[model samples]
Target: MTFIALTKPQMRGLLAKRLRFHIVGVFAVSLGIAAFCKFAVAKPRKKAYADFYRNDDSMKEFEEMKKAGIFQSAK
Candidate 1:
């Protein structure tokens, strides 16, 4: 087997040639992670918020706020 040595210019050219594919690979990976977060992480978080609000007692909260004097009655 023969070993071949690349000069700095040749190495730079090779890196430049491969840069597009590297950039595309990184972009694809970023898109995949975003998709996973949207579907897996965000969906569950959204559902949890929905469930919490669905079971929330607005009247009870209003009474609590009234007791706490958070609202001022306008004369």
Candidate 2:
């Protein structure tokens, strides 16, 4: 195989060319992580919240609080 030598300016140009590819790679990775958080992480957290609130009884809680004298009526 023949060896090729690059000058300083040629090396700088090559690095400049590769910088675009690196930027695109970083952008793609960040998009993938954001998608994973939105779908995998956020969806499950939202579902858990929905499931928890599905069986919630606000009136029952208010009655329990009333029984415990947590509120006082205005005269």
For each candidate in the order shown, give its overall lDDT on alpha carbons: 0.90, 0.89
- Per-model TM against the reference: 0.60, 0.68
User: Global CA lDDT of candidate 1, please?
Assistant: 0.90
Highest TM-score: which candidate? 2
Top candidate (lDDT) = 1
Per-residue lDDT tens digits of candidate 2, residues 1-75?
998896655644788789989999999999999999999999999999999899999988888888888889711
| lDDT agreement of model 2 with the native | 0.89
Question: What would the TM-score be for candidate 2 when compared with the true structure?
Answer: 0.68
Worst 10 residues of 1 by lDDT: 6-15
**Global Cα RMSD, each model:** 4.7, 4.2
lDDT by residue for model 1 (32-61), tens: 999999999999999999999999999898
Those runs of model 1 whose alpha carbons end farther than 4 Å from true positions after fitting are 1-12, 61-75
- Cα error, residue 17 of model 1, in Å, equals 1.3
